[model samples]
Each structure stands twice: as structure tokens, then as C-alpha cells.
Target: MTSAPNDLAFLRRLRPLAARELRLALLAGAVAGVMVVLQAWWVATILDRALVGREPLAELVLPFVLLFGIVALRAASTFAAERLGFAAAMRVVPALRRALLGKLGRVGPSGAAALPTGEIVAALSDGVRAVEPFFSRYLPATAQAAMLPVGIFLVVAPLDWLSALVFLVTAPLIPLFMVLIGKGAEALNQRQWLRLQRMSGHFLDAVQGLASIKAFGAGPRMVAEVGATAERYRRDTMAVLRIAFLSSLTLEFFSTVAIAIIAVLIGFRLLWGELDYRAGLFILLLAPEFYGPLRMMGTAYHARMEALGAASRLVALDALPEPVLASGTARPAFGDGIAIRFEDVHLTYPDGRIALRGVTFAIEPGETVAFAGPSGAGKSSIQALLLGFVGPTSGRILIDGHPLETLDPEHWRRHLGFMPQRPKLFAASVRGNIAPGEADPDDSAILRAAERAGVAGVIADLPQGLDTAIGNGGRQLSGGQASRIALARLFCRDAPLALLDEPTAHLDDDSEAMIHAAITQLKGRRTLLVNAHRPASLALAHRIIRIEEGRIAVGQAEPAETACPC
Candidate 1:
């Protein structure tokens, strides 16, 4: 919409997971840290007791009991944390998806058409999935790692301040190295994701255009395009892998060096007899344990980068601006019928291509109007304006007496039916395709609509009537059949206003006549705007409007012209 904002900032705007789930996760992590510290304390106590006295075999009972309690508590806490984290993650995903979908919905079909289908699919699906690891593993692990090291150090400080200080000072290096290495990794990860989306988009396009490739005998060329896309994706993936490997190695190296330094210092203190056997053993054991959580935390940092990369893309999609609507307004009523007026309406593309320049026209309620012009004469643009797919660059469009901009786009669209130049059909049964999931069109109504569109015969010949399954994109149906099915859907809609974009474009004479009959039947009830190049389709309209070079020529009502020789 406007200027694109920073991705990270956009991502942070998403509401975090539920507070209760986060609280439980943190509580579990705290308990787990305390358990680890207690386990360490019991081990040192057992070692000290056995060294000095002639400890009986039964004397090991208390330490073993403490060990069992520590382990059991730790296990329970781990389980709880995992369960809570997963629950929070699950809750977040749906909200994120809803937000993404809502944003896209607000953008409408014209805005969405600017982006590739594959790219949108990747952002919605794969991008959403990436956040799972961050929530379930990295997030809880980060909390546990932060709490555990501090808790362990507090316990050790009472026994030996010197050892605790050493552990604390060295632990900072692990995260420092991790941050330094991962700084570049986030950028790389973002680039990799972009490449992945592009590759997916290219692949989907190739698949969709497979028939065209076969018809032209250029299947091999299409195959080569797919191969090139795959290879580019592979290269991008390998680059991400290289950076990730280096980051992991750097974190591990720093952790190892820190652990070594702690070990050396403790060994010297014990060798010179400055430290007792019990304290030396306890410090030695606890040193590694303290660093263990830090090491895991460092690893989790890399995972955070990966999640953030995906989140960045998702945030971008969510940040798309919604259409503005006037407040304190009721839905416009079209009792007499819906009349449309364009008062000096101007429309310009984002790239500064003007489609319609100061175009003005008016259509009365229940009138059948046709827009006839050569391609790029803004005929379809006029229909798009009527449908409120795009706001005017300047001027106003009015329905009844109210400005179109003042009306809710969704509410306005609900009263309108449109048939595009190319209609899309989902892979679903005939009834499902016709009515979809939203409209619970009864069998009788569905059959009536199909019959009106002259497609009922085709359905009746099928093995299962309306229950027959259409392949992807209605591949099982011929082009004319698909058009008729789309028309059937439009008929089922039963809107007050109808916008037809070459509704009979590719049909034969008989099929064309059937569609024309359907339009004639709609004449008395619905206001119609038809975009047609053929004379037979135009004959149904009462008025013919001519558009040329982004301007409409206002003239008196005339008999419909059969052909465009202009």
C-alpha cells in the first residue's frame, strides 16, 4: 500500500502466545533448573561422605533418594514445559494465518494479482510452519537456559565464590560469539527464503502452463525453466547451510574454550591443596553443568534467526493495508434498482499507466449496458471500477446517490455478481464447485442455475450428476463447459447487479444463444454491465457505450452493434 516497513518491526506487532501458557512454561523451566542444582549438590555430598568414613552400603540411600527426586522433578518439569510450549505455538499459528488471510482479503483481487500464487502459498504455509521450532523448542530452551545457569551459580556461590565467578565470566563469551556469528546469518536466511518463494512461484507457473507448452511442442523448454529454478533454489539453500554451519561451529568453539578455562583453574586450586576434595569435585562437576544450558541457549539463538526470517515474510504479508471505509453508515438500498454513475473518474496503475482518464457515464436501474471497444480501451477497467476492486485515482463513483468510496466494499460486492474473462474452478464435486462452501444452494436451485446457463445437460450426462468430481481447475470440463459452470455460479448468486466480461467469449453458436437467453431472462430484474466484442452478446443490451484511449463517449441510447470495426 504505502511504503514498506521494516520486517522485524512488523513481526513484533503480532500478539505473542497466551500469557498463561508462557507463565507455565517459565515455571516449569524454573523447577527444572532447581532440580539440576539439587542433583549436583546430592552428588557432591555422597562423594564427600564415602571418602572420609567407612561408609556402609546402606549409607548411600539418602543421596540415591535425593537423586531420584531430582530426576523425577526434572522429568515432570520438562514434560510440562514441552506441553505448554506446544499449546502456545498451536494457538499462535491460527491467529497468524487469520491475520495473513485478513490482510490479503482487504487487498482484494486486483492487489493480490500483483503477486505470484506460489509466493503467497509459501508465505502462508511454509513460512507459518517455520515458527513452530522457535516456539516449541527455541523459546522454552532459551528461558530454561537463562534460568538454569543463574540458579546453579547461586547454589555454587555459597560453597565457593571463586568457582561461581569463573563460571559467570566465561558464560558471557558463549552468547557473545553466538551473536557475532549469527548477525550475518539472519540476512542470509532472509535471502534464502526469498529465493525459495521465487522458485516456488516459477514452478507453479510452469505446472499451470503445461498444456500451452505441450500445444506449442515446447515442453522441453518448460522443463529447462523448471530445472533452472530448482538449481537456483539449491544454490541458495547451500549458501544458507554454509552460514549456519559456521555459526554453529563458532558457538561450539567458544563454549569449549570457556569450559576448558574453568577446568584448568579448578585443577590448579585443588592441586595446591587450597581447595578440599569435596569442593573441588563439586566445582568440577557443576562447571560443565552450568555451561551446558548456555551452550543450548547459543544453539537456540540460531533457530531464532531462522524463525525470524520466516516471521519477517509473514509480517510483510500481514502489513498490507486494508481498504478504507466510511464509518457511521448503513448499507445503501437499491429498491428501484441499482443505478451507477461515474463523475469524472480517473484510474492510474501503480506504474503510472493511466487506464481511464476522466471517464464519465451513468446507467439507470435495471438497464442493460454494454461497453464495446478494442483491447486496452479501458472497457474492463470500467467494470472493475463498478465492482470497487480499485479506488479511483481521482474523482468519484456513485451507486444510487451515495459515493462508492463511502460504502463497505464487501457489502457492495455482496449485491453484485461478476463473470471474469477466465473463471477459476477449484478441485471439488460439481455441487461444491457451483455453490462452493459458503452458499448452501439447494439441489433444485443449483439445477435451475445450471439449466439457465445451459450446462445442465453436461452435468446430467456425467456419471454422478452434480456429485461428479471435477479435476483440478475443472480440467475434466471443456472450456465452454467451464464458462457455463461459472455462469451457473453467477446465476446462483442472485445478485441485483451483474458484470459480465465476455461471458460468451469462446462458445459456439448454440452455446452462445443459450447464454444470450439467460441474459435476456435477467434483463427485467438486474442491472447489467456487459464487456463484449461479439454482436450477438451485445444485442441483449439496451445501450452501447464506446470507450477509446481511456475515455468514454456519452451518446444517446442506440440499437446494439454486432461487431467492433473501430
Candidate 2:
């Protein structure tokens, strides 16, 4: 999107909170204006009474009381406005986060392929966080500043037209200068945020690949890359700061000049006997008071720009299209069987790369099929399409004569279990990771799944059994153990259609053989699609599909089943 359109969309989205917050902010300005006018009028009244030789002690007491009341009321209104504004600001954050997350989910791995994980994290965290000031403080302050000046002009008009005119003419300069200075600040702020996201992405990449770097004796190179990214980020940050300071200085300079001009006019009028001493004093005092809020708003304008820059990125992410839900479709029921058929299917990546072409295949219910191919031969792509991660570019995939697109992805997935090459493990107890949420599988069921996955012995030997804590990503477990734990999770899921992607790729011969036995037991009862190149995995398949150049060449089983070690 072009910069102008992006900004308009962002502002439009924020209009609701902006309007609500502005109203509350104007209330604050009203209180501030009342306080200033009452203070000036009280002082003028007291001076007038004294000069006229009339002592009204009760009148003096009333001014003091009014002064105290205004101050207390202004303070209370400010506190309430801030509290309510902050609450409103916080309320929008979750909705924004959900919108962004939902978009990412629809985009999936293919859409996110080019986007770095760390950058997305930065946008989700720091970018969304920046909107807080815009919603809570800067936005309200801007409104209050704007209304306060106008209110002051109305109060002064009855007392002195010249003073009110001077005030009105000069007030516009403050915001004008603020906008002129802040024009470039928004662009600079955006650059700074982008640099920070790049730095975060680089750091996360370095950390994830640290093991490989150390193995290849490239640790120093990775460290140098990280250092370079950090330096670049620091430079961008300093650039933003420099622009912000200059903007603030320029706004302050203009406001000071305007206030100085007003003061000079009031002083000269009093000296030339054109105005009363008491009136001149009041105008002089009110001159600075009138510009105070504007000056504050000019200074806070940078904060608003910074917030806008950050919010723009978040808005972009949230605006991305989300997945469309199936309409008026009943949940598919796969009863101990599933048949998948791909008819002349084709898939092209977003970047125009074709991953699959004219692929045709079929899997019978209660049959085990394995896809074997070299890297980038469409094995993973086909699996992804089957799982609804990406739709086919042409042709169609069907399950039981129903088009895959017509089925609810979530409901379809519930009957399917997937174990990728690298399975994710959350930091939690073994049972919690195995069962996930509150679907309390009995102890026997848990043990049975673990046994089928060949991990029952390992869990049984642990001091806590199924209750043992698995560190983040199952870091505490060995590769084979982690794979077994993931398999155990799959068995616990017990979906009728299973998609196993190289489930035993990294395991030793003993573990692989044990898992093969488990697979043998699962066949002829559940529909299975295994993506594998290992011999042990191939031995378990009733049929093997060979993929090459985005097309399936052979999809029939051998005359006899390959024997496996008992």
C-alpha cells in the first residue's frame, strides 16, 4: 500500500477511540479553562477592591475558595480522564492482537514464508505497544490543548478585544510549527521501527542457528552479524531521537515568540495609559496561560507521530485477509475410514513457483500409503495441500465425493492427526503436553498411547512418570525421546486419518524398528499417508507413491509386502 492510503486506513480504524477520547479530553480542557479564567478574574477583583479603598474580607475569601475549588476540580477531572482513556486504550489492544493473529493463521506458512519470525514478533509486541500513548495520553492532550486555547479566547473577549485578538492570531502558529517539524518525524519513526524489527529477526535467527554455527566454527561470524545489526539499529534510534529533539525545539521556539509578542503588546498598552493596570496585569498573566496547553501539545506531537508509525505496521498486518469459513456445511463424519483422491491437482506458490503439477492419486479407506521423493519434489507440498494449509492452484481434491474446500478445515482436521518432521513440544508436564487441555484421558489410555509410540518404557522409568516436566520444546529430552513423545501425542489424538511426515527420520535403528511395529499395528484400521525416504518407513507402507518434478510417476504397491524385523 502507498503511504497515504495506509495512513488514512490507520486513522479511520482509530476514529472511534479518537472521537471518544477527544470528548473526554475536551472536558479536561474545559476544567483547565475555568481554572485559568477564575484565577485571573479573582486576582483582578481583589486588586480592584484594594485600590478603591473598599475592604471586603468576605469577597477575598470567596476568590480564594473559588481558586482552591477550580484547582481541585481540574486535578480530579485530569485523573478521571487519564484513567478512563487508559482503560479504553487497553481494551483495543486485545482486539488488534486477535485480528493480527487471525490473519497470520489464514496466511499460514506459505504466506509467512518470506516474513521473518522475529520481525512478526516485534510488530506484535513493540508496534502494538506504541499505540498506548496515542490512545491514552497524546490524543487526549491534543484535544485538550486545542479546546483550551479557544476557551481562553472566549473568556478574554469580554474583557479586552485586543488581548483576545492577539491570543487568537498567535495560537495557530504553535500547531503550525508543530506539524511542520513533525512531518518528517513520522517517516523517521517508521524507519526506526523497521530497523528494530530487522535487528530482532537477525538476533532470533542467530540464536536458532547457534548450534550449527558452533559446529562449523562460524560462531565469530554469527557474533559479527549480530553486532552489525545492533549497530545499525542504534544508528537508526539516534537518528529518530535527533529528529524528535529538533521538532520539540522548533515548536518551543515558535510558542515562546508568540507568547513574547502578546506580553509586549499588553505591557505597551498599560504603559501608554490605554488600559488599566489591573487589566494589563491580568492579560499579561493570561497570555502565557493561554499558550501553555498549545506548547505542551506541540511537544507531545512527536509522541503521536511515533505511535502512528507503529500502529500503521500493525494495521497492515491486521488488514490482511482471514480464512473464510464454510457456509451451511455439516461436519464430515469419517467412521473408521477415509478415502482421499486428487484429480489433476496443481499448486503454484505465491512467488510463482509451481510446487505440484497435474498430480493424480487415490488412497483407499483403511490403507497405508507412503510418498517418497527427493527434496523439493512436492512431497511436503502435497501433504500441506491435503491438510488445507494451501489450496490447489487448479483441479480439486476430494474426500468421499465432497470437495475439500466445502469441508470446514477445523472439523476436517479433527479427524486427522499429523506428526511433522520436527514436532513442537510446549513447556509443561508430560501428561499436559500429551493430552493438551482438559480432555482427561484415563491413566490406562495415556500408558497405552505411549506404549504404541514406543515411549512407555522411557516415561515409566522417569521419577514422575507421565507427570514429568518437559522443558521448552522438549529440550530436556533426546531427539529420539522427543519424537516418541510426539508420536505418543498422535496416538492420544486418535484421529482416523493420520499424516506422518518422516516420523522416524532421526531415530536410531532400535527406535525406528519399535516405531515401525507400532505403525504396522495401526495400518488396516486407519487411513495413513506417510512422507518418508527411509527404508524402515517404506517397509510399513502397503503402497508407495514416487513423486518427481511435481508429478507422481508411480503410485502402485509391489506384488508382495516387504518383510520387517519383528
Top-lDDT candidate index = 1
Assess candidate 2 and give its TM-score to the true structure: 0.90
In candidate 2, stretches whose alpha carbon ends up further than 4 angstroms from where it belongs are 1-4, 14-36, 39-59, 276-282, 319-330, 437-444, 554-566
TM for every model, in the order presented, reads 0.91, 0.90
Each prediction's whole-model lDDT (CA): 0.79, 0.77
Q: Put down candidate 2 lDDT per residue, 299-341, tens digits, no spaces.
A: 6777788777787677666654332222215477788879999
Q: Residues 1-566, candidate 1, lDDT per residue (tens digit)? A: 21224554554454365557877898988887777777776787787888755588597997788788888998998799889888877877788788788778767666566667887899899988887677776778878778888877887788778878877787888788778878787777777788888888888887878889789999898889788878887887787778777867876777677768777877898889888877777777777778787777777776777778887777667655443432214487666369889899898865577999898888999999988888998998888777766678888888888888788776887788888888889888899888876756599999999998889999999999999998878989988889889889988888889999988887888868877887788886889999988888778888788888888765523557443433
Error of 2 at 63 (Å): 3.1
Give the Å shift of residue 446 in candidate 2.
Answer: 3.1
Positional deviation of residue 468's Cα in model 1 after best superposition, in angstroms:
0.8
